[model samples]
Target: MNPVPDLVPARMVSEFVYCKRSFYLEWVLGQFQENHEVAEGTALHRKVNAVKGSVPATSEEKPFKATSVQLSSPELGLVAKLDVLEGDGSFSIPIEFKRGAPQLGDDPVWLKDKVQVLIQALLLREAGHKCSTAYVWYDKVKRRVSVPITKEAIDWALAQVADLKKVAASHKIPKPLIDSPKCRRCSLVEMCIPDETNALDGKSAQPPRRMVATDPASRALYITTQGTYIGLSNGVVELREDRVTQEKVRLLDVSEINLYGRIEVSSTLIGACLERNIPILWFSSGGWFKGYASGAMSGNVDLRRRQVLASITGALDYAKTMIAGKIANCRTLLRRNAKIDVEPTLTELTRALARVKRCKDKQSLLGVEGIAAKAYFSAFDAMLKAEMGFTLEGRNKRPPTDPVNAMLSFLYAALAKEMTVSLLSVGFDPYQGLLHEPRFNRAALALDMMEEFRPLVVDSTVVKLVNTGVATPDKFQYRGDGCIMKPGMKKDLLRAYERRLDETIIHPVFKYRTEYRRALRLQCRLLAGVMMEDIAKYVAFTTR
Candidate 1:
C-alpha cells in the first residue's frame, strides 16, 4: 500500500547529513540503543541545562541568569531547549552548551549545530523574542563563540526541511552508499548486504519464471505456442494448451499464456492464469487490502475479528486511567528533591489528557501530543538531570548531540519495542495505530501506545540507573559521529529495562498490582475491545 503523504515527520537537518541507514533504522524502524559516550554526555549536560548566569556587558564581562528558555520554531519545524537563551542584559542570544573543548569555527557538526541554533533564533523571533546572533558555550574553553544566523543560514534550513519532506514521501529504500565512511555505523549493514550475489552458473541453466507475451503492444499471450508461426512477436514460446478460436479475437493459435496488465484476472482469468501459472500483483483498498495480505479471505470478503471482551467502555477507561496512573507512579519513583520537578509537568500531563481525550481522530490527537510532547519534554529533561544528578544539554534531532534527546530517542525505541511485543501478544495489530504515521516498516500504533508508558518505564529506569550507579561511565562509548551505547551495552540495558517493567505497581482500578509489561498488553486488548464495542472503560493516561 502507498503511504499517505504528509503523515511523516519533518525531520531536522541532522538526519539528512548523517547515515541514511541509521535514519532508516531510527526514523523508520524505530530501533534505538545507547552506548558509553552518550551516558557521560548526559551526566555533563545536567549542569549546563540548570546553570545560572547571564551574559557579559562587553565581550569580557561575566554573565548572569538566562531569561528566555527552550525556544522553538514552527516554520523550521525545530524546537530546542537552549542552554543560554537570554543574553547581556538585552539581546536574545541562543547559547549552545558543548563538551568538546573548542575547534576552528569551520567544523561540519559545529556548523550544523549552528544552523539549528539559527533556526531557533528565527523561531524566537516568531515566538516574539527579539534576537540578532546566537552563541555556543564551549565547556572545555569555558567561553561562548559568536555565530551569525544570517539570511543565508536561515535560508539553508528552510530548503533542507523541504528536501527532508520530499525524501520522506518517497518510501523506497535505496542501495547503501558504501563510499561514505558514515556507513560503518549503520544498523542495517548486516541485512542490506553490500556485496553482489553470485550469478547462476550458466553451466546449469535454470528456467525463466516468465514467458514473453505475443502481442507487440498488448503482450497478452502466455507461455504456450499453438503453432511455430514465424514472427510470433519475434520470439518462441512453448505450447501446452490446445489452440482455440475465441469470439472476441477471432481465430488464434496459442498454448499456455501469461499476460501482463493487458488483462484483469478473476475466477475465469485466474483459472486461465493458473493453468498457465502466471503471477500478478493483486490490488485492493482499506480493510479489504488488509484482509487480502493476511490471506484470510478468498473472495472480496475481509475478516475483521471482533474482540471477545464485552465491557469495552470499562476497558477503554481502564487504558486511559492506567496510562495516567503510570505517569503518577513515575513521579513517586523520582528522588525526593525531584518532587518539586513533578508538580508543573503533572499539571501539563493532566492538561494533555483532557486534550488527548477530546481528540476526535487519531491524527489530531497525535499532532496535539507531538506539539505538547515537544514542549512538555523540556521540563522532563530538566527533571531527569536534576533528580539523576546530571544534565541533558544539546540539540534534539537525528543522531542527537544533546544528552536529553539522545536519552529520549534511545528510550523511545527501547520502550516502543517492548510494546510492539506486548501488542502482538494481545492480537491488536501494531501497524494500524492512531497517532503515528504508517511508514514502511514503522509500527505507528505501537508508538502511540508507548507514549503514555514512556515515563513509567524508560524515563524512570534511566534516572535510577544513573542515580544508583548501576549504569556508569564504562557502560557508554562516544567514538562515532556522536556518543552512542557501547557495543555490548544494549544487553545490559535491556536487562535493567525488563527488570524495571517486571517491578510491580498497584493497579488503581483493578484493585491489585501487575507488572508494567503485562499492563501494556492489557492496554492493547482494551483498545481493541473499544473498537469492537466490548467495553466502555477508556481514559487518557497522564502524570506518574
Candidate 2:
C-alpha cells in the first residue's frame, strides 16, 4: 500500500489535472521519484506555507486566520475546504482559496464555487454561527471576491454530491458531457471521452489533439543546391560532383542557410510564419540538442513592429529587475517556509548579477553560470523514492536496482521528450543548457530549469495516486530479484500524469491559475527572447 497524501479529493483533481500518468504512478502505485520541477515546486510551497503567523502571502511567518471553517456535510454527504470565513463584523468571515482570477459579470458564480460556499455555510451553521455570504479569494487578485451561498447553490450542491457518489460507484470513468476547454490538459483524455471535443458546433482550440501515428523520424526536410525539399527517405536526394548548395533546382524563397549537411534551408522563408512561437526540439545522440526559434518578438508585435519594439525594449529592461526581485522573494519565502536562513549561495552573487545585467541575452536560470544544482537535489533525498526496477546486485551505476528506480528513469525519459516540445515552442535548443553537465543522456540545462516546478507538478500528484489506491503495489512485478512495472503500467502511468498536468494551481507569477501543463509551455516562450539576444532582461517565475 502507498502512503496517503495530505489532501482532499479536490487536491487530487488539481494534481491529476496537471498530468494523469504522474497521478496514477505516484498516487496508485506507491512509486515515487523527484525531478527538478517537483523539487522546485515543493521548495516553493514549503516556503509559502512556512509563513504562518499571518497569511500575508508576502510575509513568511505572519498569516491572518480565515474567519470560519467548514466540515464535510454528514447529512448532505459533501466535502469542502473554505479559505476564509467572514463574520458580518460580529464574527470572522468565511473564504476559500482559488487558483485563478475571478470571472464575475452579472450571472451568478460557477457551480463549483457555489457548491464550495454552500458547504462552508452549512459547516458554519452547524458551528452555531449564522452565515449567508462567503468570500472567494483569488490568489491572482490577492483579495477576497465575495460570493453568497444562495438557496439555488445549496440545492445544487446537495444534488451534485448524490450524483457524484453514483458516478464513483460506476466502475468505468464517465466521459465529460461537454469538453471543458481545459480538458486539453486533463490526464484522463485517453480514458475519458469528453463530449467537449465533438459537442461544439464547430472546431474549437480547447479540445486535446488525438495522437498522430506518423513516425517523426520518417519525415525529413533539407536544402541542397537543387532546392528546398521535404520527404520521408534518405535515398531521395540526388547529389552531383559538387555540394547540393551549389545547385538551385526548383524551390524559391527567402535567404538560404547551410545546415547539418551541405544542403541549406531558407531562413527568410521561415521568418514569414505569423505570430510564430512554436518551439523546435532536436534530440541528439547524447541527450543534448541544437535549437532555433523565431518568437523573440512578442512584445514588439504591431504594424511596423517599431512601436511595439520600442515598448517591448522597455518591458524587457524591466524584466531583469523582475528576475532579481524574484530571486530575492524566493530567498525570503524559503527563510519563512523552512525556518532556515538560506543565505544566498552566491557570495559575490556574480552569476546572478551578470544574468540581470544581460537579461535579454540569458533566457533562464539554467543559462546563468556558476550555480550547481545536484547538491541541492541530494539534500532532498528523503523526499524522493529510489528509482525502482532493474537489477545489478550491489552495484547501482554499473547496472540498475529496484523496479521503482527503473520506473523513475522511464519517467525522466518522458520528461526529456516533453522538454523538447517546450523548448521548440519558444525557439530554443532544448539540449544546450547552462546548469546541466553535458553527457550522453543529459538534457542538463532543461533538467536544471525543471527543478523548480516538480513538487506541485509531480510529487504531490504521486502522493494522491498512491493514497487513493489508483495504483497498487500488486500492479508491479519482480523478476531476478529486480522490481519492474508490469506490462500495462506505462499506459496507466501516462493516463494519470496527463491529468495532473491539466490540474490548475494558482500560477505563482501570472497570479492567474493555469494548467500545470500549459504553464510549462508558457514558461518556455518567455525564455525565448533572452536567447535571441532581444530582451533587456529575463524574469524567473515566482509568486505574482
User: Taking the candidates one at a time, how many backbone clashes does each contain?
Assistant: 51, 106
Q: In TM-score terms, which candidate is top?
A: 1
- Candidate 1 lDDT, 114-177, residue by residue in tens: 6557666777677665678887777667777777777887788777656655554454333344
For candidate 2, write residues 13-92 as lDDT tens digits. Answer: 33343444334423332223343334444553443343222222221222246432335545544445444433333433
For each candidate in turn, the TM-score is 0.39, 0.33
Q: Where does candidate 2 stray beyond 4 Å?
A: 1-400, 437-445, 479-482, 542-544
Q: How does model 1 score by TM-score? A: 0.39
